[model samples]
Target chain A: MNISEIRVLIGDDSILARKQMKDILEEVGVKNIEEAANGQEVVEKFRSFKPDIVFLDIVMPVKDGTVAISDICAEFPDAEIIVISSVGTQSYLKQAILNGAKDFVQKPISSSKIEEILLSRFERS
Target chain B: MYTQLFGNYLLSKNIITPDQLVDAIRKRNDVFVQPNTIAMHFKLISATDAEYVTKIATDKDSDFISTAINLGYFTREAYDEVKDNTLPEYLFLGQSLINDGILSSSKLEEYIVEYQSNNEMIDLELYSDQKDNLDQLLLNLFIIANEELPLYIGKYINLLFTNLIQFIGEDFTPLNFLPCEEYPVSLCSYQRINGVHPLTMYLDLDEKVALEFASRYVGESFTEIDEYVKASLEDFLNLHNGIYNVNLSNESSIEMKLDPPVFIEDTSITPGEKEQLYMLPIVYPFGTINFLFEIEKQETTSLF
Candidate 1:
């Protein structure tokens, strides 16, 4: 998905992290943005709003990001999604990548890291 | 950590020798055994309660008296008497120096109360033959100093100091013994995560916050990890051991020694229950360094 053309949805359990991702997206020049608190919320918003990109937290109550990512991807194969987590175990990372997320971000949110990943992936795509 | 902060505050003014400071802390522990132990020896507190306090204090790295009172095992009178009666001069001296000209009689009274509230010393010998009070005091000093050192030195100095503490014994763990007020550090314990006989250290901190420390200067995260930080952390551990063993000098000398530090990359390791977790953030140059430690409990049979 084109970074500028990205209409993104942000979903995470932590209020701090969600806001941080939103601010980072704005900094990166993504204009259209929506927010959600959990995986199910992300799915509902994805179906209704049909954002071009989604930043999802892997560990959340009521259908985690992994489930949400699969649910969204199964329906919207072209949807751009990124999984975020604090416990960056290799398993979680691999699962996220396998579930059709474009990328992943670690928690205690680092702005530079997210920006770098987005720029590298989207710039190439 | 506050203890070391008090130490630096004192050292900057040249109030006490490093040796003297160590002596006071060591004596405090030996002089004031576990209040529960003392209480039990005198038949003041029940055997069950004493054993419970020993476990809580050791596992939590907290004061036996207060832990007992908090647990409702002892009355307020029992906790106060023991806490107030035993003041580690070395630990309090730093605070004394900070308020040297400023501390009034009433303020001194307050410091005494705070000292009672803040101080939490344990006797490891209750379980082991180790008698090196100095070494224990030094270890405590190092942990305390790492937390106490100013931001000018950077907060990572604490991690460096923890590296040094790993040397003090075969294994180490940080206990989350007490609740911290500000810039709380994360509790950490270093032991053979899984072994037959694992040694643990207890740490206390504020659990709500992450581990970050203030920088040397205001409005910055303390990032620099230099020799000063390394040496200071080392010294703090040394003093903690020294103080821990000092008071026992006359009765017996526990062999306290340390090994070299081995740095492990940043990875997540859960301390489990023996090493309770407490967290508090310290505002430094940049961010807070979470302070952490673990406490090893005394066997009920051993306490008796």
Candidate 2:
């Protein structure tokens, strides 16, 4: 698959955050992208939108990114879910990893970091 | 820390005009200690020579630092050292004032001395970024706040101030906070941090400030309040609280959980029975905002 061919899913309660990430992804030449405003939508979109990779925030309204991560991974087992959040503490990081997240990125998301993560996953897939 | 404090101090003493203070604050980060100014200040070059260096640099489309270095007024290593060392923010404020003709160079020096002595914190230089200095400065800013609020609440406010400069524009001034039993909310977004130190923080904004603040936060022009603007406010509160929780967890091994930020309108935010409440008014150049916070007193003794 080409770099721009992969579909991306962004999950966060914040509209500004979603736009920021979506803009960066488009800038990186990714065309197909889906967005979820909550963790429940994230899980639902993972099953329906079937994105190649997912960027998830831990804290959401209905369901959090941690539980969403566990749900997607347990069901699919091959889901590439990345946890992006401001709470980068040990407990959250450990819980995210134990929940089967592929990686963790801190909030005020950086473009270079996103590009790096996307390229790594793209190459692996 | 000292920049805002000293600015507030000057305002309290009726030294500088409010318009001049606002202009100075907005221009501080844009104007740094230039080489010609430093040369003239240290008498390394005459005032006329500094002007000539500036002219030469402008004509050459270069900077005062490189022009001065090329003119052999100061060595490259000395210029590097000065550039590497950040002058205190209050000094930048002074520079801003002088550049805007609000105060002469000597008058600014006098105010600096007065500010340090009046505040009784002689080590004004140490407050540049030192966290401990901030805690002391916060205590000094509100001498009776500790008695009203609590220990970590001051820390939380300090972190909030830092985040304001980090995320939002630096044109706002945080006015003194007053204790309040009930705060009427206009357009408000709130998030709670619950754990060892539990607190509910509410950001209330009248429509005007909300528009300007959302514009600054999202880097887009927002003239009217909509779902997007309200969501932006919630996101900012969430961002600040998340970073605060991260800091607490990393630094103090204090773990706290945050709920999603919610947008509430036409409501009253009051303190709970065991909560200590306070409201701080922040003045941006565009408008004003009120950020209210209430922290619950712990049932058990504090571990740290």
Candidate 3:
């Protein structure tokens, strides 16, 4: 349950977003990390990597984060998915939470917020 | 912004060359009067006192006002009064243009009157009513191509300038709008807004300008159009479009969603066959970056 032992997955259409999140996660002492470019990739990576935490963007090309969240949650009920999006409308947030996402962070995602989430997850684990 | 608008007007009329416009803009930044000059103008302090204050300020690496205060040359109230009474930006630009021989003082005055009258901003003072003046200028300057689209061009351009000032440096001048079917872009990032109305917004620049822009946005040095540069441009477009959508939603009760930003590298991008695309050129110290908005004519009821 140590921070470095926790596996992390970042699903974002923007390579910049994924890299930024990965850098912050690394800074926070998370060693094992994976990235996906779209919703389909998110699902595929989730099944293959079985990451402990997933950060999913709401908008993508092939599939979207909402469906990805639903599919992952339905299959892995214990999966901890955090919806990361640029759009933070009320309806989007509600739909994300409804689809069984553990939390939501609006983009330009801050490192402090990521650190806080990681710290809380560390404590809980 | 008004300076740029006026410069564009002059350019369109063939009264000033592009080089002149750029020169005037560069000179605009140098038009500020030093504290000694202001003090001399207002007779707030003697020339000797001003010189003494300037010497102390330089030696201490402090500002004229602070040095004057420490030297007991001027009170805080006097300093504030001098600062507030300085010339406005537009006037400074006009004076700079005149000094550069681009226009005579009388011609400058004539043009100012004409510009104000034509734009129906006669009451727009250069300094005191800036926010309102900008609102008026943007509303008057931006011409919406499609009749169906709301008068949101002003709002969009306002938000653009605000964000540019926030993220990028405020040292930029927005040029006149030009209509073109295709732009030879070295680097471009765009996002589509879908909902009650659909539109595509693009940020396009040359590779060198893109590098400088990306570096400015992320506070990092970028020498090439790499993944990080592309992502930074995409993120900027997304961030700006996100704010625009949120504003529209909050103010007009219109919900809109953004598609993930797409980056086009080393290619020319063309507007859709039926879409009306307008290119707004913004001149920065680094280079010119063009913003292209391709808005299709919606067949639905007018949202405005």
Candidate 4:
């Protein structure tokens, strides 16, 4: 996928995590990027950024990714969202997929994970 | 009740050697002597940055942001800024290597799609895998060692291999310690270094279990480390080792060794520095646990 052509939204609660994700996204040639701190923020950013892919955190302060995904999916069923989280439980993974999240990424986000998410969601689709 | 019952159970089972039991305690007192701590001592991060994440923040149940933001180091906005970018802590790079780039690009994309499209909520219940089991055992070892030798250094380590073995019922090989500047040691990616000091321990269990165990130990009952707690911890390791031994008794008669428990005071011991005191780590069911001891004399009740 061309980095400059992809539009992405990043969400999470750890400052260190956000930086790493941003760096990794840029590394994969992603240029149009938006960011959010929680589920609610993701919603706001999702509307504003209208990204091709949204990376949402599972756990957050104002709103969690799960609820946000539900709300966004209800409104924009085509919304492309991924649950970003530190805890990797099977149940959560299943639920995120059910709720409209396109994928999930564990904490200490890796560059490869972001690249994979973008390529599959935007480039392939 | 938890400590004595668990300790005696392991001792009677003969899972861990007397020497290993003692070493566990020593390792605990010297807990602060890890390579990361040593890095702090060497001024890698500011004194504030070097401050170990408190017991609460380190726990599995604790909220990550609450732990960091409560520190008063960063404002909500600043914290949010970093959090949104998904910037990883420097410590996590090592664990990411397993599947980060190893999978084929298409396979990786498939997993990501599965991840993003999924909407399942994670259950907060505690579960055990071989990794969790190993973590539980290592945690017990740490608890037991800390109980016996509150002032001595305790250490744990994990052996790294391309392929991880997770047999249903078998004892695995223990970790092999490399020589350290401090004698005791410890990985995650984006970070690597060596050190010395006798008061550090390391483990390479699954990060999930490590986070869970840390939460359990730090949250319940352990307010400030003291003698009473240390004794109980020693017993915990003893029992845990016994459980571990039973899991592998069919394959080998390998016995873990321990040193006589002792105390430490005043004299400084730095980990990842001073190369003379290194401990070798062996692989267990899930991972490795290793430690080094720094002794001090003190009067205490006999270990009858």
Q: What is the TM-score of chain A alone in each candidate?
A: 0.83, 0.95, 0.96, 0.87
Candidate 2 TM-score on chain B: 0.67
All candidates in order of TM-score, best leading: 2, 3, 1, 4
Angstrom error at residue B284, model 4: 23
Each prediction's total of clashing residue pairs, residues at least 3 apart in sequence or on different chains, is: 94, 0, 0, 98
Write candidate 2's Cα lDDT for B128-191 as tens digits.
5455556666765653434656667666777787788777865566666778888889999999
Q: Is candidate 2 or candidate 4 better by TM-score?
A: 2
Output the worst ten-in-a-row residue range by lDDT, candidate 3 chain B.
Answer: B120-129
Q: Which regions in candidate 2 have their CA more than 4 angstroms from the true location?
A: A123-125, B10-109, B117-129, B143-146, B297-304
State which candidate, 2 or 3, has the greater TM-score.
Answer: 2
lDDT of residue A100 for candidate 2: 93
Model 2 chain B — which ten-residue stretch has the worst lDDT? B295-304
CA lDDT, every prediction?
0.46, 0.79, 0.76, 0.42
CA deviation > 4 Å runs, candidate 4: A123-125, B1-304
The residue-by-residue lDDT of candidate 1 on B125-204, one tens digit each, is 12123223323343344334444322211212343333333332111122222332322223322211112112222222
Model 3 C-alpha lDDT per residue in residues B46-100, reported as the tens digit of each score: 6567767777888989998788877787788986776767454456555566668
Error of 3 at B39 (Å): 6.1
Cα error of candidate 1 at position B220, Å: 13
For this target, which candidate reaches the highest DockQ against the unseen true structure?
2
TM-score of each: 0.38, 0.77, 0.75, 0.35
Tens digits of per-residue lDDT, candidate 2, A22-53, equal 99998888999999999899999999999889
Question: What TM-score does structure 3 among the candidates reach?
Answer: 0.75
